[model samples]
Target chain A: MDHDSYSDAYLKGVLEDVRTIAVVGASDNPLRASHFVMKYLGDKGYTIIPINPGQAGKEILGHRVYAALSDLPEPPDMVDVFRNSDAAAGVVDEAIAAGARVVWLQLGVRNDDAARRAEAAGLRVVMNRCPKIEYQRLFGEIGRIGVNSNIITAKKRPVKPTKKLI
Target chain B: MSEKKSFGFETRAIHAGAAPDPTTGARQTPIYQTTSFVFDDVDEAASLFNLQKVGFIYSRLTNPTVAVLEERIANLEGGIGATATASGHAAQLMALFPLLSPGDEFIASTKLYGGSLNQFANTFPRAFGWKAVFADTDTPANVKAALTEKTKAIFVESLANPGGIVTDLEAIATIARDAGIPLIVDNTLASPYLIRPIEWGATLVVHSTTKFLSGNGTSVGGAVVDSGTFDWSKDGKYPALSGPEPGYHGLKFHETFGNLAYTIHGHAVGLRDLGPSQSPFNAFLTLNGIETLHLRMERHSTNALTVARFLESHPAVEWVSYAGLESSKYHALAQKYLPRGAGGIFTFGIKGGYDAGVKLVESVELFSHLANIGDSRSLIIHPSSTTHRQLDAEGQTAAGAGPEVIRLSIGLESADDIIADLAQALEKAVG
Candidate 1:
């Protein structure tokens, strides 16, 4: 539970293992970063249960909203917190209570105390990172943006959709 | 990295798409000059080809340097994404490629660059079987009337070339919205510094980066910015986006990418097949030019206003068609859309006619007699004899390039120097 950088293997493992993501502070507004991330993850074949207290009964990007992580129909595999650091502590506590295997704090939403507490509860933690960007990066998508992806090959390959069990 | 919405235009222009080279820590964006990138493995290479991952495969498809330029332009224009191409003409073609198939029609403004006119009237219809019905967009009714079941998009320029006519973008956008088609605005002359077309309800914006966006005229490049607002999947009309494609295992782009469908398709399919890709070096130069866009555009606007005013008062000038001038028909529209100033290019009729227009071009010492606009150096052209010479008299007038007209692209020189140079040239032509 050291607060050092997570390796590519660790990130890729987390992404492959997680099935459902509960996006805290999700909004219906398309301009919001949370909304875009929810839509992107959903398109990538992840089950997204949007968590926004203000929009508990409504729908965002075709997913029913939950008032909080506790209100979800079932425990999410990963709790992706989009709220600020102060709000993130409460969300991290909820993630532990809900028995989420991984607690992910989105870009700029980091709290060391929360990370420590999550680790104490035996939960894997990712802080201050976007899951969508990471999924593309680890899976060889970021190479499109000119980032150096360590993998290199001359042969063309078809992308098979990742196996999903909903 | 924080979202770019918090940054100012100037700050975004300098840093939006650019970050220090991850490998070298080089502050400047390095030109990844290679034709192809080495894929890490067969699976990684397959993922890139499948569009399952976003990474460089080929230079004709995407380059890192060009990607930065695309990101910067999209940031400046307030779009979701962008695709950079070989030239402005290519950008126009790319913008319409996915939307229009054979026998489909699109409404266009008559007040467009003559080159665009030729492409739309001649090339598009003949080669692709796509027809462009030009409507006088001075009235919004004409745009609305031009719409038919076959129409897919409504195209116009924010500020018409040569004549400096500022379009009533809001009114035209309303027409485009009612018709449920994307508003494709060619913002080449205005350069986002004067106006952002997306703010006025444009679905997509195109730019001739060869002009003011490059600022120095050192490179020829173009960009297409997707607003990500239009719902291409709503109607069955846009099949290329909504329907499954044969290219990538029946992948529906709109369903897959959501807001980024058009731009993603432009990169994945349009640029991939057309091979009209901008060079990484050109993108690097254009990115450098954009850093000083705010400063250059301001000076260009102010200098243009001074020149316009001087020409309006000059005895040798018959009329000036600058939107910045109070007497211009497009003055009110210009104020609403381009409050900064009415851009740096405009046309004026000389006292004597076509011969005097030619004389004026020959007499000017400081202003370069050339076909190009939006350079750091002032440029003068008698479009009837140059850029629009291919068009007939009726076509010339429709494109706003009459025989007596002389187009001027005001530069960032001293206002007094620009005025003095024009005045001397005018006297030589008329005397």
Candidate 2:
């Protein structure tokens, strides 16, 4: 798949298909962006599984934590990697072994090799992007920061009907 | 532009929120004078209204030019986000709006601007049903004693206006932290150049950009900078930020935007309803004024110290209350908070009382007898007769505006020339 060819339709399709996201290296610290993203996605009605070996048994924002992606009872629809770029490859491998359908590297965390490996293994890959920001952008939210999103209309968009896979 | 944080204060002042117009290549930020924005279609409009997207719908909420100023002030203050308002009073209202509801109380320093004192003491209680408990913040113990179950926030000024006294922000901030409330510091006098309250543990900093920020005293504007440090979700005391907001479709700001919740809520809810939004033109002027803030503040401090020293030695001068003066009670506090200088505004007591205070205002040649401060040209006012007339005699004295007191806003003039003007004025007033 062409990296630059990840169009709006493709991104939207992935977002609509994914139900549960297992976040690697999730933290309980509210100041951390990972914590915010986890809470934001969870508030948006997504099941968020926090993967932190250091805080495996503890709960963050009321979601039970897992030691690693492998420790999950079932495979997540998406594996959101919150670790640094160097640590992304290991997380991506774990996601692949867990049979996750999508591997997402959080904003500022990019690994070309990991992305390539994930795509070669028949999993979709997103790098250096945050799902919260993307959701806001695709759903027409980024305009408040003064960015031109190009899609402007006075009429409200109908909420897309959700079909729960779980 | 890319390495924004690495840039010096001066560089960031000029370039932080400003970029050349992408379409027209205009080097300056354009004043978007329109009242409302046109959406591409109904879907986009719906998304903006739903907070599903971010864009301008109406000027009553946000505007492009004001957004630039907001971003610039936020960057300069080392804050995550900012909300700009029509005036300093409006900024104060917005700053407290998201933090207080009916029957909710907040502690405020008694040493505040006369206008602010009246607003906090009377208007907030009568109009909004929010009570403001005035504490003699010269000591942190007074503030600690004022806290109750109803307390939601603590307010203070980095440098008390007219009085020229500096606050012990760290002491107050500690008290606020222990009480689980946000410490809101009015940094109008200190600005970001002289002191940053956030670095001293203040959760938020408010500024009357009309003063030193605009430097020219040209525009009436204000800003609130969120350090994004306070935990609004800690015990859910601040339901406006942590819990579901009924106004915004039951959206929880803290859970949704995290650290940026205060500013986002201020813009989305406070500004949306209050309608005290800043004009783009005012924002543009304020932004232009900010570019030279570092330079102007330094000069303002130096000139003020010279003027203060001159007044301290004058025969007709009963006393002076500039923190830069070693004899001042606030000298130690000024040293801790304002290492640069004690700012440009100070008050002096005339030996002849209120009549002489009036004479000085009428006698100054170069200084404009006005209520404004932070101008390139000098300004003088008899606060007892003008700004603080509404306050009782005791309130006037407590706020540092005694009957014999004359306030001076030192400007960027030749030190000798400014002192010469004051000498001539003092001679006439004393005689």
Candidate 3:
């Protein structure tokens, strides 16, 4: 579905009201792609509950990081899966048991079985798209390039052909 | 969110402005490119004149197209109200006019756009006898120390221009609240997609729609967003809100408009008198840009992170400062405020130094060396020679555009292509 199909009333009720999101496979390292994504979504008014067994119970982005979805204070609105495909099915099962309303896999992290299982559990499925990117795209916030340009950005230069001297 | 419960962003973007246009039953907002509106009768004109009714009387005050754009922006920005202006600078000025007067001051970050630095250092003092005390905005302590009784507000960019540095907004917002002043953030770089300054305690938000919102290098425009949380009524300093307006006889804005007082006043006073309203055409263009902002920002961030890492390892590169890169001082902060992505723009210096920097920019085929950022096509500029061309040596260094610095507004192009172009340019520069 196109982003424009999502009205503000829908966004406000379902999107903005997403109080907590458990981002599975979250990394502690600042350079890790997952780390920034969690931090960004958290900062964007969502309560990001970081999930990583390696760094479970440790604080990430000032929120109490957990090892699993079940460890969260309450069921999150979304469980954003960022793990490899091999383990996604198990993660989906965990999400179902944890009673999450939605399951989102990050770009390039896909699992059909896990997606199916989550869908069976009556959860919203968003695969292969980053929620942050989705938020901007949906809200009409994209910065377009080239199309709206009429003014030449190039300087009025004194063009001279390169000449070889004997 | 599903279609039943949740619609996509593209859907929300188009239909967020109330319903279908009543005038022509237009499903989409039509660009009403006109200067004035006519009244049905003398009494109707009198109602608009008295500020007792809501209707478009002048394009400068309100236009059908501009109103749709304003409402869309306000919704997207998570603001209660927004005012569109002719340029980003105009938006800043219009937001400030309501609060500040002669001798009144504002505290600002030194790490700002060259244009903003020039605006605060030069234009503000001369324009209104108003002055800005520049302080380092990165630290919470430094921001707090800069506050004073004379200060009317605290202004900063969501992300510093060119520098690609993220501001500590929550702390600054807290400072503004404690001091009974508004925290105004220029969210031009870290557009609402990356971070919403309003939710993070910013009382007012300003944007230069010329950059990211318009995306393409189209028309110049600016916007002011009110969070509807700042208690303007509590402050006695703002006579514009509390006192009677000469235009409207004894109608107190704070008493009447309440949360929307600034928005109404901005529409009625700032745009009405300053006549810096944004064109409907520009607003339409910006709205189109907004629809793809999220997708573009994602690609831009990924491309930037890839490019930043590539430069960090390149032999011909001196230093790169992209928040996505772990080495950047702003990386930790970037993670805090903008985890989804650290924006599309990054800055670096060439190993061959200033002359090589100049050659690299001139040699690039794919990269359009320009002043603007957040473009879909990759852009390169040796700031010392272009955007920061006017700055002296010291000022140049302070703005993160040292003699060797080459700023890159990473676009949505293939990462390999962008890298190859840079590599070839570097090779040609050194040779």
Q: Pick the candidate with the highest DockQ.
A: 1
User: Per-residue lDDT for B236 in model 2?
Assistant: 78
Model 1 global lDDT (CA atoms, 0 to 1): 0.85
lDDT of 2 by residue, B331-421 (tens): 9999999999999999999999999999999999999999898898889999999999999999999999989999999999899999999
Writing each residue's lDDT as its tens digit, candidate 2 over A1-166 gives 6564356666777888998999997988754567767765775668999999899899998999999898899999999988889989999999999999999987667888888999989999988677877775466443344222223222343323212211
Q: Over 4 Å off in model 1, which ranges? A: A1-76, A79-98, A101-166, B1-5
In order, what are the TM-scores of chain A for the candidates? Answer: 0.88, 0.88, 0.74
Assess candidate 1 and give its TM-score to the true structure: 0.79
Q: Which lDDT tens digits does candidate 3 get at residues B1-431?
A: 22344334445555444334444556555788888888766754664675544457888888767776676666667776788899988988898989888998899888888888888888989988889888888787887897778898899888887767888888888888888899999998888888889888998889898877778777788889888777777758888877777777667776555565788788888888888988889988887787777777788889999989988998888788888888989888899999889988889989878899989999999999888887888998888888887789898887787889888988888999999999899889977
Least accurate 10 contiguous residues by lDDT in model 2 chain B: B1-10
The runs of at least 3 residues in candidate 3 whose Cα sits more than 4 Å from the true structure, single-residue gaps closed, are A1-166, B1-11
B175: Cα error in model 3, Å:
1.1
The lDDT for every candidate, in the order shown, is: 0.85, 0.85, 0.76
Tell me the tens digit of each residue's lDDT in model 1 across B1-431: 23111667877778766666655667787898989988766755765686766767889999989987887888788887889999999999999999999999999999899999999999999999999999999988999989999999999999999798888999999999999999999999999888999999999999999999998989999989989799999988999998888898777878666666788899999998888999999999999999999999999999998889989999998999999999999998988999998889999999899999999999999999988999999999999999999899998988889999999999998889888898898889998
**Measured by TM-score, how close is model 2 to the native structure?**
0.79
1 against 3, candidate with superior DockQ: 1
